[model samples]
Every structure is written in C-alpha cells, then in structure tokens.
Target chain A: MKKRAVAYLFILPAALVLGIFMFYPLAYSFMISFTQWDLSATRTYVGLSNYRALIVSPDFWNSVLYTVYYVLGVLPVSLVIGLGLALLLRDSSMRGVGFFRTIYFMPVVTSPIAAAMGFSWIFHTQLGYANHLIDSFGGEPVNWLTNYNGIFQLLFDRFGVELPRVLQGPSVALTVIILLGIWQNIGYATVVYLAGLQGIPQTYYEAARIDGANWGKSFRRITLPLLSPTTLFLLVMFTILSFQVFGPVQVMTPQGGPLQTTSVIVFRLYQQAFAFYRFGYASAMAFLAFSMILIITLMQLKYIERRVHYD
Target chain B: MTKRHVTLAIKYAVLAAGAIIMLFPFYWALSTSFKELRDIYFEPYGMFPTNPTFSNYISVFSKAPFGRYLLNSLVVAAGTTFLQLVTACLSAYAFARMRFRGREIIFFLFLATMMIPQQILMIPQYLVVMRLGMGDTYQGLILPYAATAVSIFFLRQFFRTIPKDFEDAAIIDGCGPLRILRYVFIPLSKPALATISIFVFMWSWNNYFWPLLIVDSTEMRTIQLGLALFRTEGGIQWGEFMAGTVISTLPILILYFIAQKQFVKGITLTGMKG
Candidate 1:
C-alpha cells in the first residue's frame, strides 16, 4: 500500500494534466458532437444530425478533398527529394555535408508562420520573384495564389481546350500550399533518412559490389530494401503532420483561399469553431478528421511492420 | 574525367541546386527586410538592395507591441517547458523505477495519447479553458502543454538506461523517490533532459494554432501570432513583415545553432519512437 501510494504520487501530476487536457476533451468533444451548443447558447441534443449534415455539406466534403489532395501532393515528392539528398550527403567521404545539412534544416526549425509569410511574398502576384522568373523566360506572369482554377485546367484553357470541371487538378492556390508543404518537410525527411542511412552497414554494399552489382542495381536491390523502415517511419510522421497543417493556410490564405480551394479540414475546423462559433458542428468534423488520420496511421503501421526488415 | 569523378561531380551539382532552392526564401527575406519600400515595390525582382536600410526593422518595432509579444512568447515557452519538465520527470521516474500495480497500464495510457494529435482536442480544450475562465491568460496558453506524453515517454526511456546501482545507493542513503530522482537520475540523465527541454521549448515557442485560439488580446499574442497579425493588419508591407519574421525566428535559430546536436538527436528520436 505504501509503495502504491508513492507510485501514485509520481504519476498524479501528468495524469491530471493529460486527463484535463487530452482524455477529457476527447470524451467531451464526442459528447458535444451530438449537440447543438453554440458558445453563447443553451445546449440542445441533436442525434447524429451534425455528422449527417456533413455528409451533404459541400464545404465539409471540399475540406476533405483538399486535405487528401495535399497529402498526395506533398508526400511522394518530398520523400523522393529527401531520399536523393540523403543519399548524396550520406557518403562518409563527403565534405561540407554538415553545412549543407544545416542549411537544408534551417527552415524546418524556423517558425512555420514566418516561413508562410515569406512564401506568400514569394508567390506575390506582381512583385513576386516567381512571376519575375516567368517574365524573364518570355512567359506571362502567373497569379499563383489568387488563381482559383486548377493548374491543369488553366493550362488546357490557355490552349483554348476546355476540360470538364471534374478533370481539373488541384487549384493554383493549393498547389502553392502543397509546394510550401514539400519545402518545409523535405529537410525533416532528409535528416531522418540520413540518420537511417548512417545506420546501414558498409558491408552490405561491399558484398553487393563484389557480386558485380552496378550502382543502379545496388541501389535498387540494397538501398531501397534497407531504407524501407525509414521510409515507413517518415510516411507515418508526415501523414499526421500533414493532416494537422493549419498555420500556413491560416497565415497565407486566411479566408481558406479564393473559392475555398485550399480549405483543408483543420482550417475548416478552425473556421467553424472560432470564426463561425459552430462548436457542435466543428466537434463532429474534428471526430471525422481524427478518425480518418487514425485509420491511415493504423493501416500504415500494419502494412509497414510486415514489410520492413530490421537487417 | 573517370566515371566515379563524373558521378561525384553530379552529386555535388544536385546537392548544390537543392541547397539553393532551400536557402533562397531565407536569403530573400533577409534581403527584403533590409530594402526600402521603394526598392521592394519598384524593383520587384531585386536580388540585393542597392542601399540597405534599418527602416523596416524600425517600422516593425514602432507599429506593434512587438516587444511585448516577444516577452509573452518567452514567458509562455519557458513556463510550458518548465512545467512539462517537472511533470514529465516525476512521471518518467515512476514509470521507469517504481514497482507497483497498474503502472504498465498507466504508462500505456500515456503512450496511447501521443498518437492523439492536438487538432482533435482543440475545440473542446478551448471550451474547457473558457469554462474555467482561464481564457486570454498565459495559463490558457501554457497549461495544456504542462504535461506532454512524448516528453514523459522519451525521458522514461532515458532514465531506464541509467544503471540501477546509483539509484540503489541513493535509496540506501535514506533518500526518498523524489530525492533519488533529484540526486541520481537527474544528474545522469542531463543530455536526455536537455533534449526534451529543447524540444518542448521550440515546440511551444513556435506554437501558433493554440495561441491563435486562446489569446485574443494584443498584449497576450505570441511572436508567431504577432507576425501573422503584422501580415494581415499592416497589409503587404513586405519590408516590415520580413523584418518581423526575422525577429520572430532569430532567437530560435540561434538556439538551434547553439544546440544543433540535441535538436538533431531529438528529431531523429522523435521520428523513430514518436
């Protein structure tokens, strides 16, 4: 009993704080999802109405679609770029690798809001450097952020070929945001991949070379298979981080982009709860978003655990 | 050149190109922060200012309560880090060294919460804060972060690696659990504690989403929130905005430089075990 009392004393503080902040809010958020409780109004029970309403709500669905678009847009590109950088810098013979690593990682440590502000300036319509580059290339300046139409559709439109709305790709606004996501995350992925690369033994590559495996063949047979765990690790971390991407959207395009093109689920949740004061509805949206991320993480963990090799 | 030399050249060329792309925005921000508004507007593609000025930095300080925002951020970040360390150390010690019933279950519960991202709890947590009348205060900003599952988990892993001899000796000297933690575990786990502290500090320092929700007053705003406010309220004053960005990020950047190893180790550990 005395031992149990001492143990409880140590655990009490963290459990209390987490209970108040994490576990209780989780339960409360679920309870609030079934009610209509605006911040100022009386609570009224509405059975599954909030969830049912989301099914038909275009805004809610648009948020989901944009979020999925962001995940798909940022993940593979950053992973490839990160792996490339890691491989280049992973050679023990390489000099100035630490300097390059520090340079690549500077943005990751910097404030995302500050980074977004800088990016917003980068994509500024007229005075932006991106448009200046386009002008130098003998091309028309692009309004990167304000252009609400899909990039593919816009490209097709330039040729006077009208494609169906359904076939249009991610909006220019979302494309810029996706680009920013890739930029911000590639450093993290590179650093993680570098650490993983350093862990792999030199003997594996030596043995492969002794078998007369060429560089490309060795990379395919040895590097890819060996790096699967790191890849899986990054995928899960990036998925969760990507799902919670709110700062950039909030700072750069506060109104969720022109025509709601960049209305990610977290941004939508923020807008609903705080901007519109629809607590109950936003709680339902939160539950849905949470469940979506949870399912993805679980699926990835199960799939990767079986496939990833320790050696 | 030989094939190996050619490949090495290609690798350097690729890394150099990637580095340029990664570093350009930062260089742009720094350059633009120094340029006059006329240079920014008239010479849109100006890579370097012809005549740099401190006018934007002057403007950033004058236009808002930037100093107060900096103070607020410092206090909140420090407070959160301090509280998280205290709570995490206690819990980590219990989980690492204590022999008691339901300990595994409790530790598992803590670990499970690590997967529950902050977005899921934001609305309800906000409501709870408001209900408790803690809204618009530093406590509101710092309280929710006073305990972190990740820190506890990380510290517990570190504490377990410290050999049992030191802890046993401390206990034999009539030291209590907390005393053993103070005298034995803490002295040995400095690096891990430092890693967790830096992680907590940086996480809270750059935090935006929660502060945006809770802190509505001008004086209560964090530096990141202050920058956002400067962006929207001050219009496309790129010069001042970049200056604010520099101000907001410089401290953390310096910290990163000073503690680069801890930051990298913490990040890698977070990736693997987080």
Candidate 2:
C-alpha cells in the first residue's frame, strides 16, 4: 500500500496537468466543434453545421489544395537532396565532414520565424539578393512573394497552353514558402538519413563490391533498400510538419499572400478562431485537419509496413 | 590513385558548395545587420559590409520593447523547461520503477495524448486558460506545456535502460523513492537529462504560435513574436529587421554551438525511437 501510494504521488502532477490541459481540452474541443460559440456567453449547439460549411466552402478547399501543394513541393525534393547530402558526407574519414554537417544542421535548429524573415529579405523581389543575382545574369527579376500565378500555369502559358484550374501548381508565393520548408527540412532529413546510413554494416558494401557491383549498382541494390525505413520515417514526419506549417506563412505573407494563395489550413483556422472570433467553426476546421493528417499518417504506416525490413 | 584523388576532390567541391548554400542566409543576415541603410540599398552591393556598424542592433532595442521580449522569453522558456523536467522526471520514474495498479493502461493513456496535436487543443485551451484568468500571463504560457508526453516517454525509456543494481543498492541504504531519483537516477542520467533539457529549452524558446494566441500585450510577448511583429511594424527597416533576427536567433545558436552533440543526439534519439 505504501509503495502504491508513492507511485501515485509520483504520477500525480503530470497526470493532473495532462488531464486538465490535453485530455480535457481534447474532449472540450470536440464538443465545441458542434456548437456556435463565438467567445460569447452563449454556445448554442449547431449539430454539424460547422463541418457542413467547411465541406462546401471554397476557401477551405483552397486552403487544403495549397497545403497539398506545399507538402508535395517540399517532400520529394528535400528527400532527394537530403539523401544526396547524406551520401556525400557519409565517410567521416573525410576532413571537414563534421563542419559540413554542422553547417547543414544550423537551419534545423533555427527558429522558423527568424529563418522566414531571412528568406523574405533574400527573396524580397526588388532589393533582395535573389533579384540582384538575376540582374547580374541579365535575367528579368521574378516577383517571388506577390505573384499569385501558379508556376505550372505560367510555364504552360509560355508554350501557349492553358492548364485546368486544379491542374495549376502552387502559386509563386506558395512556392516560395515551399522553398523555405524544403530548406529547413533537408538538414533534418540528412541527419536522419546519415544515422540510417551508419546502421548499414560496412560488410554489405564490401560484399557487393566483391560481386563486381559498380557504384550505381551497389547503391541501387544495397543503399536504397536499406534506407526505406528512414525514408518512410522522413516522409511521415515531413508530411506532418509541412501540413502544420503556419509560422513562415504568417511571417512572409502576413495576409496569406496575393489572393490568399498561401493560406494553409492552420492559418485559415487561426483566422477563423482569432481574427473572426468564430471559435466553434475554427474547432471544426481543426478536427477536419487533424483527421486528414491522421488518415494520411496511418495510410503511410500501413503501406510502408509490409516493405520495412527489420534486419 | 589519381582517379581516387579526383573523385575525392569532386566530393569536397560538392560538399563545399552545399556548405556555402546552407550558410549563406545566415551570412547575409549577419552582413546586412552590420551595414548602413545606404549600403543595404546601394546598387552593385558589396558582398561584405563596407563599414560595419552596431547602430542597427542598438536601434533594434531603442525602436521597441525588445529587451522586455527577451526577458519574457527567458522566463517562459526557463519556467517551462524547469516544470517539464520536474514532471517528466517524476512520471518517468514512476512508469519505469513503480508497479502501481493500472500502470500499463495509464502509460498507454499518456502515450495516446502525443497524437493530440497542439492545434486541436488550442481553442479550448485558450478558453480554459482565459477562464482560469491566465491569459497574457506567464502561467498561461508555461502551464499548458508543463507535461508533454514526449518528454515523459523519452525519460521513461532512458530510466528503464539504467541498471537495477543502483536502485537496489539505494534501497538497501534506506533511500526512499524520492532520494533514489534525486541521487541515483538523476546523477547517473545527466547526459540524457541534458539532451531533454536542451531540446525543451530550444523548443520553448522558438515557440511562437502559442504565445501569439495567449499573449495580447507587448509586455508579454516572446522574442519570436516580437521579431515577427517588428517585421510588420518596422516596415522595410531591413537593417534593424536583420538585427532583430540576429538577436532573436543568437541565444539558440549559441546553445547549439555549445551543446551541438546533445542537439544532434536528441534528434537521432527522437527520430528513431519516435
């Protein structure tokens, strides 16, 4: 009984905090999602109207589309570049490898808001370094943040082809935000990939070499297969992180950029709850975004589980 | 041998280029922070500042309540880190050592809370905090994050790895559970504790969204929120803005430089275990 008392005492503080802050709030959020609370005394139960409105709202759908564009734009490109960087720096015997690793990981530790500020300055259209560089190359300056045209549509237009609205890619402004996401994530992916690379036994490569495997052949046979778990981990992680991206969007394009093209789900939710004081509606959006993320994560885990080799 | 040397050279070249690209933004921010407004807007701008100045950094403080923001951020980050460490240590010890009733079920419950992302809870949490009269207060900022499932789960895993002999010897020496945790577990688990501490501190420091939600007054703003607001309010004061970025980032950058190993280990541990 004394031992049990001690155990309960040990767990009490954390359990209390989590109960009040996390679990209770979770339940409360679910309840509020069905109501018409606007930070007023009255919270009338509305019964699925919030969700119904979200389903049909073009703004909500646009936010979802932009989020998908941000995710698709950031994920594959970062993975490829991260893998490339990991391979380049894999041999620790090389001088300055640790230095290179530190440099790459610097942005990972950086505050997203701060990094976004730096990026905004760098890509600031007229007086930014990017435009300066373009000017030096005798190329026309691109409107990075203010441009609302979809990049793919722009490309297609140059060839006199009109792409469908849904087929248009992320807007130039959203693409800039995606670039920031990719920049911040590549370091983390590289670090994780480096750890994964280390776990593969040195003998695997030696044996492959003895079997007359070339660099590309051995990499395809040995490296890629073994890195699948790490790849899966990064995929799920980046998806979740990118999906929750709000800081950069808020910083670079405070009003969600031109035409609200850069407004992600979380940003839209923020606007609804705080800016518009529609707590119940925002709660519904939150649940929807959460369900979408949960579904995507579970799907990834299930799809990747069969191929993940424990050995 | 020449071919191997050539490949080695190519690898170095590629690495060097990547390093430059990675470090350029920071370099530019730092360089721009030191340049005068005229130099910042000068045509055919020089790569390096012609004449470095500390005036922009000085103006960053003078133009806003940046010093107060720094103090607020310090208090919140330190308070949050201290509370998280206490809660995580106690619960981790209980989950790892104590065989109480409903132990596995409770542990699983705590783990399940990890899936409840902060976004879903923010609205209700805001209401709860405001109802409790904690809005724009340090408690509102610190208390909600007092017990994270990640820290508890992390420290529990760390505690389970420790040898049983130490606890056994402590028990034989008339040490109570609290004493064992204080003397045996904490003393022996410095590196793991350090890892968690650095991560939580950095996370708390960089957190912007929560503060944005709770804090309404400038006096209560954190460095991140302050820097962001500074960008909007300052409006094209790029020099001062860069200076603010530098100031806001300096503490974490310094911490990272001092404890790079812990930062890296934290990432790997969380990445793999999570």
- Top-DockQ structure, candidate number: 1
Cα error, residue B6 of model 2, in Å, equals 0.9
- Top candidate by TM-score: 2
Q: State the displacement of the C-alpha of residue A38, model 2, in Å, after optimal TM-score superposition.
A: 0.9
lDDT of 1 by residue, A1-311 (tens): 89779989999999999999999998999999999987766999999999999989988888888898899889999999999889888976688888899988887788889889989999999889988888899998888887789878987987899887656777999999999999988888899998888888899889989999988998998888889999998998888888888999988888999899998999999888888888899999998888999999999999887998878
Instruction: Give all TM-scores, in the order shown.
Output: 0.97, 0.98
Candidate 1: stretches off by over 4 Å: A158-167, B234-236, B272-274
Worst 10 residues of 2 chain A by lDDT: A302-311
Model 2 deviation from native, Cα RMSD in Å: 1.5
DockQ of each: 0.69, 0.66
* lDDT, each prediction: 0.88, 0.91
lDDT minimum window of 10 residues, candidate 2 chain B: B265-274
